[model samples]
Target chain A: MKLSDFFRKKSSGSVAKDRLKLVLVSDRTNCSPDIMEQIKNDIIAVISKYLEIDTDELDIKITQTEVDGTTEAVPALFANIPIKNLKVH
Target chain B: MGEVIVVTSGKGGVGKTTTTANVGTGLAKLNKKVVLIDTDIGLRNLDVVMGLENRIVYNLVDVVEGNCRIKQALIKDKRYPNLYLLPSAQTKDKSSVTPEQMKKLADDLRDEFDYILMDCPAGIEQGFRNAIAGADSALVVTTPEVSAVRDADRIIGLLEANEMRRTHLIVNRLRADMVKRGDMMSSDDVVEILAVDLIGVVPDDENVVISTNQGEPLVGNDTLAGQAYMNICRRILGESVPLLDLNGKKGLFERLAEIFRKN
Candidate 1:
């Protein structure tokens, strides 16, 4: 089995696979990957001015979600920020 | 009521016309009355692929523009028990037809046939718009290449936007050997990227070329591409058909020929 596997060509290097992975995800989200990164950064910058967020532990994701009693699902963006301290007004 | 389905591919030359001919012919062979409308207008080719080219006396433009009755332009195919072709006008351009006219035509055809297959022209232009105007379902054909799948993705989005939710994918001209060697995209990759139900995967068979050259559809029981198309037609009727093996597995002929070698 190992010999046959070695003789077989690897499937990961096909250019189509990588390009499709990025493009399809971007398409489903209705935003390009670069735009997504820019949005994430702008969000972090705006929120960080008031509270100290754990930048290393921050998580941002765009996912598909089904709301209550809905016939179809909708795209939802979720962001998790670990707050270390809040600014005193 | 008949279902109007448009066979579309955003990129050209990915076997849209061939699929329309085979699926329509295959359905007809199943004793269902099927009508194939060439919506490509001046770039008509479904008639040739179905071997009904020379018989076209009237075309789609004639039917739409009131030059001829709908029945007067419908070319009946004797090869199949219940098949017909409504060829497109070779002189009139795509602008000659309108979406409203196509919708009205679809309504008129609903009561007359079991399946209405529209052969859509390539590109997301006026031709594509007019082809899809009357369709409630779609079959987007794509090759296993990046460009083809990308274009197919766009077409699927457009189909969904138009509320043609019953969309399926047909991956055409896939070379199984190349796929195994990791040189070409596999069927799974295409279905994953396109995110649609796969209706069929047509193996890259030389018979497709030969049949096209002869102005005939490849539907022989023993031929690989032909058998694949027959399977597609069966699935269109809501039957569960297993996909044909185009990979390294020995086919029936190869296994049977082994007996002769041993003898």
Candidate 2:
């Protein structure tokens, strides 16, 4: 018998719980992993139109965590956009 | 005393029919007058799962078509004295039954039964709309898998848009062994994503197949899965019961020690 077969099995509760979270996150955000990457690129491009930024330092991510009994997903964008020391036209 | 419940899942093969059979049987075992209506039309299997296929002389189509009375279409269950089944028509498609027809039928049955459970066909189409039209509540059945959870989320959205008063989750066919090995999704993960009140978490048991094949529901005093079904039934009757803790991963040494102690 396999090593795993010897152990008392864990319940299906955890697996079902985790799968629903990942799917619901994707469903609510309407952003797949690939789409999220594209959205990050778009944000960088839009920000660069106003100021020069360190593109390599830019970060865009969607994080989900449960607080109490409720789960929440937060979308965050961080960028170090540098403005040139010049008077506005 | 009567409540209309729609058993729905946006994806196929998530055990919607099985849930309907077991829950209906469970409710009936509690002496609640329950009627299970198979709304799958041409793809009907509630009759087969409930072991009432051979007794299905009249179907939902006959009742809707006015060819037969609703009383004639309802097949009484031999196992449960208070349970009845309205089998779906094998010859007709889903389009044959209108939402209005279903609503009228549900209204009429509500006066006679304590619970009316509709076995909705899979997909977010006309069949789903028809199933939920008369339902006061819904139970979304899903497995602890990515695809099934995604579909379940979509179904929840649809149910909300329809202004369904109460919607609960029934996570079905969960394999405890696979979950512990990180090969399957967990119930907590599913509940987090769906963000709905959970009705029950049924473990994947081979006995389910055996019981279904034998045309016997898993709510009787025989197997663990049957006990789980009975627990769900009690919850439906307004009783608070703790879920079974099946997540223990004891080692072989522990099992051997326990066996030795028993000896």
Candidate 3:
């Protein structure tokens, strides 16, 4: 068996879907890549004041999410921040 | 009073004009009085697409500028009894007409026709704004591609911003075989990404090109694309028509051709 057969490859359709999901989230929220980076940096800076965050593993992105009580999907900011420890004041 | 609908796509060459002509013609075939207004002012093609190019004496600019009456500028299609087309002005640019003028024109036409379909120009410019000025709803067209879907999302955002809340999606030029082979995005995938209500999905068919070149709209025909357009018209009329099954078997000619190629 070829090495390629060991790992399943993603179809082009799924690839397009994944890419469109990212692009459209940014488009709908009017958040450019630069704006996303700035938001990420600002978020890190603000959170760093009171706690230690793993900046390397921190992920911030705008995505479509279902509201609490409705089927309508809206653009939402999703941030995954791993806090190392809290700063003693 | 008639309902005014704008057919728009933010990107060019995504079948906006073709959808306008087909859907308008399809509605007319259903015995509804329909009027298709070409809003791509400087680059008018609806007249040609509807096979009414040679009959244009008074264009949209003439009616808007008081050079002629609205009735004088409306060209009746010979195929359908109640179908008409208001050809755009090829001489003047999009700046020649304002949103207020288009609104007045749409309001005037609403009294006469049952359905008024406006073929909007590409891009979110003054032309796009004018097309959607008096529209009660919109039909946004997009192809099954990354660029087309992205542009469609932007157009949907603009339509929502303008408070045209009743927007429908038409995904066109879909290749079924490619989708079956996992090469192209399916209609479900497109609707999932865009998050819009899908009115119809037109398969990629050579008959559309043939019909366009022949200056004929392919509704009430036996072709796949033709049936798709008719289904969209039914849905627009508040009928619950299920989406076309794209994975259906191919025609005899296509199957034969495939067999011959394999040999």
Error of 1 at B165 (Å): 3.0
| Candidate topping TM-score | 3
lDDT of 3 by residue, B51-141 (tens): 8899999999999999989999999898889999999999899999999999999999988999999999999999999999999999999
Structural similarity to truth (TM-score) of each candidate: 0.79, 0.81, 0.86
C-alpha DockQ for predicted model 2:
0.34
Task: Give a tens-digit lDDT track for model 2, residues B1-263.
Answer: 59999999999999999989999999998999999999998997998898888988889999999999999999999888999999999988989989999999999999999999999999998899989999999999998887888898899999999999999998888777777677777787678667899988888888899988988888856566787778888988899999876544478998899899999
**How high is the TM-score of chain A in each model?**
0.63, 0.43, 0.75
Superposed Cα deviation of residue B250, candidate 3 (Å): 3.8
Q: Candidate 3 at B52: error in angstroms?
A: 1.5
The lDDT values for all models are 0.88, 0.85, 0.93
Model 2, residue A7: C-alpha shift (Å): 20
Model 3: DockQ vs. true structure: 0.71
Model 2, range A1-89, lDDT digits (tens) per residue? 67887675645556556545555666776778899789878886786676666666666655555456654554333344444433344
True-contact fraction per candidate equals 0.61, 0.58, 0.79
Q: 1 or 2: which has the higher DockQ?
A: 1
Residue B212, candidate 1: Cα error in Å is 0.9
Name the regions of candidate 2 deviating beyond 4 angstroms.
A1-23, A29-45, A51-72, A75-89, B247-252, B255-263
Off by over 4 Å in 1: A1-13, A28-89, B248-263
Model 1 steric clash pairs: none
Give the TM-score of candidate 2 (chain A).
0.43
Ranking by lDDT: 3, 1, 2
Candidate 2 chain B has its poorest 10 consecutive residues by lDDT at: B242-251
